[model samples]
Target chain A: MTLEITGLKVSLGGRDILRGVDLHLEKGRVHGLAGESGSGKTMTGLAVLGLLPHGARATGRIDLGGRDLLTLPPRELNKVRGGQVAMVFQDPATSLHPMLSVGRQLTEHMRHHLGLGRAEARARAVELLGKVRIPGAEEAYGRFPHQFSGGMRQRIAIAIALACSPRVLIADEPTTALDVTVQAGVLRLLRGLCDELGLAVLLVTHDLGVMSAIADEVSVMKDGLVVETGPRGQVLREPAHAYTRSLLDALPGEPGGPAEPGGKA
Target chain B: MSNTASGKTPLPGRGPEQARARRRGAHPLARFLVRRLLTAVLLAWGITLVTFVLTNLVPGDPVAANLGQRALGDPAIVAQWRAEHGLDKPLWEQYALHLQGLLQGDFGTSQQSHRPVAQDLAEFVPATLELAGAAILVSLVLGVGFGVLAALRRDRLSDHLLRVLSLVGISVPTFWLALVAFYVFFYRLQITPGSGRVDPALGGAPPVTGLQTIDALLAGRWDIFASAAGHLITPTLVLALYTIGLLTRFTRSAVLEVLGQDYVRAARAKGLPGRVILFRYVLRSALVPIITVAGLAFGSLLSGTVLVEAIFAWPGIGQYAYKSATTLDLPAVMGVGLVVGVVYLVINLIVDVLYGVIDPRVRLQ
Candidate 1:
């Protein structure tokens, strides 16, 4: 395991958001965290980064390569963030700074973590842009976020998350805001990056179809707790928990039917 | 899924919107600016109409006010005075004549000063602009600074203190504040110079921009600048107090809102240092609203300086307008009205231009 969580609990304003949650993500694999909204899947990802909203409290162990992130000093945690465990969020439109150019956003953390000079950071930013399959990488450097389409903006966001060459990536509903045609491209890119970078990825989404596409291991969460965990095939094919089975039943078309293109199973 | 096979096709990032947005980038700013300018010109003409109509509608008798009772008793003198000021003509003809003169850069003659209204404005406007400019600068610096601090330390001692201070700032009456500031700072403390733009002893700077401080600097007269600056300190503070409070409240809320945005979270998630996140992510994003508020604050400061100017003896358009209205100097009143109207329109235009500069999205639309 590149990252491990044991007995993670989170609460905010006297309300429990996550209750004794545990997850393990291995390097070179995609761990899909499937849940409905407010099920604490998003909260779980935030907790790992120590980026919970103000007034929220968390107690648990987040072990990243034997270093406990929960106990790490803020200064140390700052280095670990973007440097070792970067994140890509839902709604790329809001995730990227509107005023800043794509290249600047990509290079800002690179310079911060790697101590790269201006030229070095620029080169790396362009290269990362290319890696994300963004066309006209050189010319795209100076364009603002509003100039890009939704899918293109998400690609830029993914490029930024990969800027610092982090060991683990927590992608929260990375393709939720994207169109159906665009979703497959992003998912394929995430899957490829996981293998190419040998990085542990925690993919948080509500779409089971997305899990089927790229996730190797699947964890189903409901109401702040994981209800079941297994390989992608087993969780989708034979869910042990009643809630997980109900979620599958909620999908369109008949259960055990062959999945249709551009349609959910 | 069957769609997965088609989804394998390469998807270009660029879309119609992107192409359109890119094409728009070339000349939209120039077009936007030109459109705004044309609108401002039309509004300015509209202002002239309103001012002309409103002054004529008022029950004041400019002829009696200027001629006095003894002169009004003589029928010949009254007729000549009326004819001289163009009051003898029909209202429409008088408006047509005024518009024609305005196009020729004439602001008519001031019944009080007996000089051209434009000349009177030229002499007095600079003082008000100087005071308002200084006050706005001071307010922006302190307001935005304290506002960001308040937001960062929200619900803490500093935040509470600033909130209360801002509340007092907003609630306090301007005239009363001006009076108190004058008495306390000038009479009791004697630290700041009393009313007016410069000490009578220094005889002021050679009028270039008409702003004493800048004119003095242009002439390289440090002594004059210092004296002018000293005189400016009290009134600027008095005038800025309300705006500082207004801006502080506005900026705090704006910054707080930006802090809640997803980009701020993304900045932190990228492991940016606390300072970087605050300055680059939080404050930069917060600037759009702050700029908006600041521009309005500046407009109000320029027009709203009457009470402060009265107490400080600063020669600005507000005081000119007050005297003009009191004496029923119709031409002077209209001129001041035009100036005020143009000031607002110009400030609004500036604010729009600034929005385009700060947020590219503004320029495109």
Candidate 2:
């Protein structure tokens, strides 16, 4: 399944946050949404998931697997959420319900969307945890989110998003809160999941390095508008937009050292 | 590798040694319970002592109050009465005697009615409990319901209306509200029966339960039960309005806070229905504060029944305490104080235990 968002616009409190954003994601690929803070990257992700805050109005088309999410009723939209599409938030510490056990949180989406019984949901929860490479998945199920490390918690969040076999996964800065080493592991895990499950991932982040690490295709957003988008290697080597070049220049260490970024020396 | 790495990090004070130490000792909850129980006992004792001292310190001679004008004319008779009642003894000696009587389940005697304080409390405490319990039930249902509604419809007309209504409910004095309720519901509408527990025409039930509604029901006197419940309605409503307003405000703020949390958004993004999200995630998270407020509101309602009982002529501890205060019945006043203290302690304990149940973090701590 492919996730396509076209001409997405969002306004909050009479102020336009997202002017006109567009992006596309295909199965078995990672689409990086790279932008600076307040560039509407997160807003685009929220609009796609229908998770905009109160008094915020969104317009335009959000097509997920041939369904127009922007036009879908809330009841139908809910069926699409976590069933056809799911999201992993930036801060995993706050993403999972603090009071609930990991197992319960993982199984809740599956049980609600798939109408799976307790036994079936529990089995799938364990399986999802294992897929996320959480050691001792069965024991980890009974543990709360606080018991896990930052990287582990993000993996659990990903596991929950994957519980119902969603076609599209919106990972909003999934590694931003982790250590550098943990970031690589999470990025690698997401990359592996995209290939293994043929999952189309909308990886929203402000870090161009992250995009270089895993994104197959990249879209550069600035002021709620997509400035440039193309295959990652081509976009990085010969950027059409000057803003993309500056963003690459702003990355730490050597500025514009080589066309191939995120490569270890 | 992740597990081994995490395990290798020294947890500082949370290692296996500490876990073993915890295993050998009483559980945290057990220790907490024991500590709370001890505090409750000490608090109850302090309340009794304070009540005893304050009552004694009040300007007036218990002997003269009891003996009327006769004791004023004869010093010998006054002395005799004081000695007989142990009032002539040292204050500490009298306190010791009071404690001795309390240990034996004695609450002294009412000066006005010449009845044992214990007996009067037995008759009155249950009535107040019944009234406060019913009032709390009303408050919980209406307050929590309106609170959630206001939160969900935040900044809307319905929210504004509920906020104004709760403000009015909270601001209006209980006595005035009770009178208005009586005038409107009983006199004008004729929907509810007049005051007192039940109609004197129905005689009385066997007093098996002390609570008129309960005893009447137990005795199979539906007419008496209906009449008693009807009389209870105005007073209960009058008492409940304050708590309803308080709880509504509390619950609204609590729910609003929880609704803003990231987990609530996650729940919504998970495709869970709005109703399920509200109840399961939002309301459940908000319950800690609501429960704390509820327990406190109930405690205040128990003590606040004085004006409501006086206005409605409900035969509850508040009315009895008021009567005892006017008559300088120190024993009865102290007895009421002791019971109220114990009731407050018990309610707080229940609230704490409920906190553990609602939030596992509290229980684990």
Residue pairs with clashing backbones, model 1: A260-B1, A260-B2, A261-B1, A261-B2, A261-B3, A262-B3
lDDT values, one for every candidate: 0.88, 0.85
Q: Taking the tens digit of each residue's C-alpha lDDT, what string does model 2 give over B196-302?
A: 87899988788887888899989999999988888888888899999999999999999999999989988888999888888788988898899999998998888
Clash pairs detected, candidate 2: none
Q: Write one digit per residue (lDDT tens) for candidate 1, span B229-304.
A: 9999888887888899998999899989998999999999999999998888888789999998998888778766
Give the winner by lDDT. 1
Model 1: per-residue Cα lDDT at residue A103: 84
* Chain B only, TM-score of each candidate: 0.91, 0.91
Q: Candidate 2, residues A1-265: lDDT per residue as tens digits?
A: 4988888999999889998887889999999998899999998998988899888999989988788998899999999889988999999988888778888888877888899999999998999887888877887887677777788889899999998899999999888877665777788889999999999999998877788889999999999899999998888778889999998888767585332222322
Best by DockQ: 1
